[model samples]
Target: MTVKIAVLVSGRGSNLQAIIDSIERGYIKDAAVNLVISNKADAYALERARKHGINAVFLDPGRYDRSGYDRDILKLLNNYDVDLLLLAGYFRILGSEIIDAYRDRILNIHPSLLPAFKGLHAQRQAFEYGVKVAGCTVHYVDEGLDSGPIILQSCVQVLPDDTEETLTGRILEQEHIIYPEAVRLFAEGKLKVEGRKVRSLD
Candidate 1:
């Protein structure tokens, strides 16, 4: 069975492109991206999807409140029959409506190692806070903020001369790598979450 995926993204969607590339290159096999949805009409991710001949659309949030917005998203997910929801740089905090609807089926990638410097500007937070190690985390999406069980992580050492941009550049590289890895694991039924810990089954 091919795993059907729907990507929720905002902004450039570099991770979205990575997943697409991974699927196309057979790094992540037996999975298809059914739809790509973005809140911003001008998001380049939509363009990336259309360029690949994949279905892509922009959902307007002005027409609905938080739960209503989630309802709209759920409608699309059901419409596409998406098996997995992948969030890539989506800025909005999801409500219980969406979280409960998708539950453990939704995954999100955070820029920091998680449980630290969550939310926006995570790279900047790590840089300004002068952390020696900064990396990315792939985790399940919970109602709480980046409090989900971590599936995979790749670390990038923060050099003494590293600025936010340089550090982010490195972390984004790791993001491209691990995001697909997590998706592939999920597709292969190799991921099990228990008590805030994600176990990888071979």
Candidate 2:
């Protein structure tokens, strides 16, 4: 069965483009991004989706309260029969309604290694804190802030002359690679969640 995916975005969808490219190139097999929803009408991610002939929608945040907005998102997921939800640069914290409905089915990619530098501007947090190593993590989305089971991670070295921008750019490169790989694993039924760990079934 082809896995139907719905992506939520609020910024430039670099990761979204990566997933689309992966699907088109057959790196992610038997999966299609059927829907792309953005809270900002001007989000370039929506444009990326439309270019690929995917169903892209801009759900105005002002039209509804937090809970109501999430409820509407749930309605869209049900209407489109989305099997997996991916958050790509989406800015808002999801409420319980959607989180409970989707639970383990939702995936999010963070700039830092996770369990550290969570919340916003993770790359900057790592850079200013002077960490020697910085990377990206793909994990399941839970109620807590970026606290979810780990799936895949790729590390990048923080060079001696690297600034926050340079480090962020390198970390994002890894995010593009591992995020799609994680999605492919989920599509192939190669991922199993147990306790705080995500076991890859080879």
Candidate 3:
């Protein structure tokens, strides 16, 4: 059975593109992108989805309250029978209703190692903190901000002369690689969450 996915994005949707590429190349087996949702009307992610012949929808944040916005998203997910929700550079912090509805089925990709830079400016936070190692994390989306059960992580060494832009570029390369891997694992029923950790069954 193919696992249907609905990817949420706000910006360029590079990670979304990675997943689409993987599925097209048969790297992510038995998986299909059912829909792409964006809160911003001008998001390039929607254009990317259209290029791939996928269903794309925009839910403007200004139209409703937080709960109402979540309700609308949930309604769309239900209407499509979407099995998994993936957040790739999605700017909005989802409300409790969506989290409760999806539970362990929703995933998000974060720029930092997480538990370190949870909200924003993660690459800048790493550079300012002078961390030698910084990377990306793909995890289940919980009620807390980037505080979900970790699914997968890949670290990149921070060079002494690295600026925020350089560090972000390095991390984004790994993000493109690992986000699709994590989603493929979920699609194959190879991921299990035990406590705060996620394990691959195979």
TM-scores, all candidates, are: 0.98, 0.99, 0.98
Candidate 1 structure quality by residue, lDDT tens digits, 1-202: 9999999998999999999999999999899998999999999999999999889989999888778888888899999999999999998888888788888899999999988899899999999998999999999999888889899988999998888899999999999999999999999999998888999995
Ranking by TM-score: 2, 1, 3
Give one digit per residue, the lDDT tens place, for model 3 in 1-202. Answer: 9899999999999999999999999999999999999999999999999999999999998999888998999999999999999999999999888888889999999999987888888989989999999999999998888999998899999998899999999999999999999988999999999999888997
Which candidate number has the best TM-score? 2
Cα deviation of 181 in candidate 3 (Å)? 0.6
Candidate 2 C-alpha lDDT tens digits along 89-142: 999999888889898899999999988899999999999999999999999999
RMSD to the true structure for each prediction, in A, is: 0.8, 0.6, 0.8
What pairs collide in candidate 2?
Answer: none
Worst 10 residues of 1 by lDDT: 94-103
RMSD of 2: 0.6
Off by over 4 Å in 3: none
lDDT of each: 0.93, 0.96, 0.93
